[model samples]
Target: MKPVNIGFNNMVMDERIVAIINPDSAPSRRLREEAKLENRLIDATLGKKTKTLIITDSNHVIMSAINPETISLRIGKGE
Candidate 1:
């Protein structure tokens, strides 16, 4: 699987990613809360401000400090 860097030395399987969302949205906040409740949340922000919410195919939610657009570009570049 291709891995995409999400910043702070974090990388996620590109193919496993289902969606890249802005964390500021109400729906995204709700999703994060639900993911936390289910214990499927992965905090990859490394204490930095969360800029993006990455939803994986396995129902895992990943918080990243990197922007969604940048992450999307990385995926497109196969990085």
Candidate 2:
């Protein structure tokens, strides 16, 4: 994986984003579209540099980190 240097703003930017989609959720068309957009960004930018993404939900926690060639995730339940 290639190394990179990500800044704090980038992480802050992503904190405002969420990337999960459960086809059954009752979101407005616009919110659904926005989720799709965030999902795309997650796929494209998730694990860059030493940057890691932390996502939490009511029942789970997901941690994601990446390098130029590798993307990894760790999941746990409030443990």
Candidate 3:
């Protein structure tokens, strides 16, 4: 699997990513909370507000400050 940089030097495996969605909706927010409660939330925002949420196959949620579109581009590059 290729390693995709989410932002701020954080990287995630491209193959493991299930979905990347904006975290503004109620359901997304609830998912973030649930991930937090389950200890499966990874904050890669580095103190910044989360703009995107990366969901993994293992049910882990990764919070990122970068836009989802930009992350998608990086994943496409497969770098």
lDDT per residue for candidate 1 within 1-79, as digits (tens), equals: 9989999788998989999999998999999999999999999988999999999999999999998999999999998
Local error of candidate 1 at residue 12 (angstroms): 0.9
Ranking by TM-score: 3, 1, 2
Off by over 4 Å in 1: none
Provide TM-scores for the models. 0.96, 0.19, 0.97
Top lDDT prediction, candidate number: 3
Query: What digit string (tens of lDDT, one per residue) describes model 3 on residues 1-79?
Result: 9999998999999999999999999999999999999999999999999999999999999999999999999998876
Better model by TM-score: candidate 1 vs candidate 2: 1
Residue 60 displacement in candidate 1 (angstroms): 0.4
Cα shift from native, residue 19, model 3 (Å): 0.2
Quote the lDDT for 16 in model 3. Answer: 97
Q: Report RMSD for candidate 3.
A: 0.6
Clashing pairs in 2: 47-66
Model 3 scores a C-alpha lDDT of 0.96
